[model samples]
Target: MEEKIHITDFLVIKNAELEIKQINVLIGPQANGKSVIAKLLYFFQGISTEFLKGIRSQLSKRELDKAIIDKFESYFPKYAWDGTGFSIVYTINDIQIEIHGQAKNKTKTKLSLKYSEELKKLYTAKKRIFLEKINDNQLEEEPLRGRGASEASIYRQHILVPLRTSKYSDFFSDPIFIPASRSFFANLQKNIFTFLSSNVDIDPFLTDFGSFYERAKALFKEDIFIRNSNDKQLIKNLYKAAEKVINGEYEYKDKQDWIISTKGKRTNLANASSGQQESLPMLIVLCVLPILKNPNLPKAQALTFIEEPEAHLFPSAQSLIVSIITELSSTFDLKFFITSHSPYILSALNNCILGSEVLGKNEKSTERFQQINNGSGAPLDFEKVSAYTIMDGKTINIIDSEYKMIGAEMLDEVSDHFQDVMNNLLNME
Candidate 1:
């Protein structure tokens, strides 16, 4: 089963085709459609959730179609719809879905959808059984508005359980988008859910991110009381790696997030540094991944979209953050899709790829790789890594096929340009 996407005439993106991979990185300047592409991927990958929503609500074919369209429009607001027209084609495991958007009138826009027969057949069969169960009063008619455990459990039992045994199970994982404005939610952690519920003007992506952020934090509210020592040690190692990135140990107290420094001073998020505020939410997720993967807790596989993970950090810290990601990815069933403006993060990822290449050639270099950066290094599968840079309504692959890593020249171009400016100024005398 192959996974790929084609997007054309969408926002700043004129045309782009990307092969989805385990480690996908999109690097570009601001407003060059990096986030736009990320959101589109999120929306399409999340079609499984929409399908479940359709069955749970007993939506008709037309109603389901409208629901999906509404979701797409919500992600791309009316202001973003100013584009003349757009089309997106997403294929995974041979199930293809196409969406075309056009301006129907000045006041309205219509999104036309075409789904593969496999998807339609699966949805129809599931919906039929769901309707039969409802008619027989064999399943609870749980309200989905709460989005609480009961609703999740009901859906999992009715839909996910069956899908898990089928060939389409790979499509069931949820796509979680962690937006660049994650710090805003981190600062409002105490009241984010209430604020989001009361306010409708906030971006839908932020709302979803806030929810996941909250869950990640809650994972650390209590102690990790696992019986497995290896699992426990892995969590400790991950948290230690994360601490180097944020420059402090994270603590949750009195229903708030706090950071304890090396000197034992405690600073709550409100009084903490901007770096902490910006990095805390992402760091918390890094800390919680292993905990969620524990056999005791309910485990879930997810396609995680991380936007500007290097936001408000030094270059060394940025490298450490990438290390944390690689370590977790190596250990867990998570795939990371990263969007970054920082070449430091990309360079750090390249280091991981290079380490993998070295190890691939000579297994004896394993010890040498571990010696780099105090054992923070983790080897990546270069085959599963893909990098692209977006500009001028297009994306260019930056991954070097021969080297099996992002090319050094691509990472150095921006730095080299600024250095040339410095050199000219120095010679002005």
Candidate 2:
């Protein structure tokens, strides 16, 4: 069974359904909060207590607590939080979870969780405590300063996993939260491989290649020697799916720095072209490892979120990336959610749909294309892919490639529309 995520009332993804092997592309104008949506989801899994405390400074304790409670209630049956005075209701694998949160005005917020029968009892007790503390007179006591609000506690309890080109250690751990920054790519060349090959007693040069070397050796029927060949075959393959080849080599002497030889043999990752050069390594990290980590993991069940994958590459590279993502989805139990402003990426995705259709034309062709029961199988339809444009005023309108309107706004839209509803509820004495 695939793990599905239904996001409601969080960032720009008001109401979005993300399933495995599915590619969800968020396209539209800039500053439309695509990054915000991505950040929220990345941090949704295991929110840290420290981060939650930081967000508490924005709203009153009563209002923040209610918002947190509502969020938990929506995801019920799958996951739960207890103690902490915050509650979460979401289902994963048929199991129900109820999250609890604890906040004492400006004091530190504590979090706890419950499941099944225990979740209900915990929630009831929390609800009573929360209501009892909602006295209007407490408003003058100066809402929780700093990271001690109920909302902060709730956010800290749910984690967000980010893959960016910047340093965000407060949120991610090594091999878990991958930053898309230049240093991150450089580190992949230096650290990732060595960490994987720690158990093997191979030569130092081979050891420097890390897990990538092992994976390459297993995939291709040949040895990838760093110094002996002097040819660019291995480097060529690395840049095979990429547009421009900046420079990639296994460096010796400097165990810490993995040199990226860009234009004019300048051996610094900082010197490489901005977009594609920066994007290539991130793509390798985001795409390849997830597949290698769990071979049996279903493509239709995994959710991979990428932000601005079209960062640095030519049109061709962008197109290739779209194809790679599509192929990955088709092969593994994976679902891809990416935010892009590049028309080339969108066009490439459209081409995948067309290509699939062409292959589904005949019985033998269809069988080859779908790999299922000849022409009787369903053709590859891109319509199953959903795209949304987040508009101003918190309104998210679903649109097609040509900006054609697709009916059915998500619950996020409803919440945005009823902003006054929340304001009124919070203001009620």
Candidate 3:
């Protein structure tokens, strides 16, 4: 699949064609459909072999269709729909998979799978997903429901990390989400675990972070966080990044169940400072990526979505965290889709872009990179990074092919306004 996702009138998203890259950054004002776009990508990427195979077990095509619709409603919420519905299309290689969901009833959703002309000639059903209801599920070849093993396999290879703490583990393994409100993790565990453990048919978008935190914590046993890394320096870089985020270093003590040690002081996650709490889960998740799967190859791609990593952090730490992500992206072959509202984050990214350009000419970028990167590792590869800002109901790409930022007026204006305010105060003196 080409890393681009085309969304048409899905909820608040009127029409969007996002060309996602290895490091895609979405920076926009709140409630402008940024999260919606991320969630849509999550859902689409998650429509994998396991998901399709699960639907195949259903007795009727109607039941399968209903199941898919219900999943979408729960995953994305019906209220986001602006009554116009949505048409999402993904073109993988030459085969096309299109999903049309009407915001109204939602039950009126349609999914079509079209193959290339040459491939169409061989398949019994050129375009699977016949609107005609097949009476018997067993006899009706899966083409009736746009089912294909190869296509599912193609999608399943791509992973998505939506990073919404609430529904963290709904699709993936346990402990998927690490929340921004991690400081209150202790209280959250009590409430969220109760909800997750219950039989209630809650929405998938609704998650209990505490429950997922416990799950994520469980994955840390037996050097699993440091499993198969031949790169000692890379692992060191990861720790160095983690150390920069937290004011100090921390380790998970499995025996006490999430007890953390920092500067020889022992405390639970709740007792830790806000920055420590915020950075703890992120630090662990970053280290754990290499160990998430075994026999780790150099080419494996891991897609992770991180929401507002700057939460509870100072400006310096914010820049450090972004650089750490940059280092990890190159180290682990990770594809990060981050959503942020932090000016520090944007400025740090800007520094990275500039740093890459200067480094290409062999001029020393250490000072420039270190200042913007807040003392982190290698500069970010701007070519792999695509940044977009949502304004007036549109996600606009800020950088061009040469990594020149086009729409930075809003950030500049804010800084100018701050300077003007400072000058006004000085004038009184």
Candidate 4:
């Protein structure tokens, strides 16, 4: 199903599209609301009316009112409302899921979900169960609706499961609103798992080299004994992959432990490098493995958001990362939304365009390139790529060096103005 999510007034984003497979790279100076856009798209589900209702019930009347007012002032600077309320609307596969509310009082919010055929089925089944439980109690209406609300009375159990399942996990797992203090530790644990278990083949080496018995004989200097065990061979292969970027080879002694060989001696990963250097293995593992393991996930009709992927890597690595992104999009059914401040990453995308042109010289490939070069022919064509620059005001404007704005055809004046600014910046630096 094609999925499109539109968020309004939840944060810095006034309105924006969150869709999959197409890479939307947001670039601008600091405080231009780039991170705000990421937060809205990634946490759309968590900001729903149901979740907000629960939050309001936990806060004091004044605190709840204050929170609502603050979110409005921050998200919509030009507009102000005396009312305390927020809403999120999500459209997926022709179904509209809307959750909206306004503060009914300081301690309570009037919240409701706009039901669809899909949600209605789940809601009906749950409502029936809730009514059966309430009928068994035979309590007074006022007390049932008031402080004695049980779990079954307060929530529709079946409907609640749908809200908490994997389909809605992204809302809570979003890196932006989900507090970095807790997420940092969670992410670290996930990274460690990827580092140890990913992309290592063991069975082939074991069968070809006999097994543990052959290795024990080799230690006694016996002829025809296995030269290397399966564990050692796997470690050697891992080391070779690491050596492609780092200075030395890495060895995995056990499933949980790894050692790096520098010079002629072996050292634990922690002791092999300083604290700063030790962190690279984890970063590299996280950045590269996610794409490798689920290269086809983008094709699954879900949006994927990545923020500042160019952190803590050299220029060459950054270029390679962009190439990986380009290759994955072309080879799989995926859309990518990425944000970056690195000029090198942008230049790498530019090279993808140029490289495609150069490779189209052959008559057989020329027609294909022409189709992609012309936006009307293919949905994934290069023309579909757009770059937006966020201006000093909250407005985002599109700019391309190759095209002149309509009614601005004086090339000489435009060139002079650009050169003057470039000279001034250079002089200041």
Q: What is the alpha-carbon lDDT of model 2 when measured against the actual structure?
A: 0.44
lDDT of 1 by residue, 370-428 (tens): 57856675788888888888868988888887767674567678889999999999999
1 against 3, candidate with superior TM-score: 1
RMSD of each: 3.9, 18.8, 8.6, 15.0
How many pairs collide in each candidate, listed in order? 0, 67, 2, 5
2 against 3, candidate with superior TM-score: 3
Worst 10 residues of 4 by lDDT: 174-183
Model 3 sits at a Cα RMSD from the real structure of: 8.6
Mark the regions of model 3 whose C-alpha exceeds 4 Å error after superposition: 49-52, 55-67, 91-95, 103-185, 190-227, 254-262, 293-302, 363-375, 400-407, 427-429
The runs of at least 3 residues in candidate 1 whose Cα sits more than 4 Å from the true structure, single-residue gaps closed, are: 105-108, 133-155, 190-200, 224-230, 294-300, 365-368
Give the distance in Å from residue 65's predicted Cα in candidate 1 to where it truly belongs. Answer: 1.3
Whose TM-score is greatest here? 1
What would the per-residue lDDT of candidate 4 be over residues 58-129, giving only the tens digit for each residue?
443345445544443344342332244656666654456664656675454554456356544543454565
TM-score for each model: 0.89, 0.48, 0.73, 0.48
- Candidate 4 stretches greater than 4 Å from native: 17-21, 44-85, 99-115, 118-301, 357-380, 383-429
Model 3 vs. true fold: TM? 0.73
Residue pairs clashing in model 1 are: none
After aligning candidate 3 to the native by TM-score, how far in Å is the CA of 333 from where it should be? 1.8
Q: lDDT of candidate 4?
A: 0.43
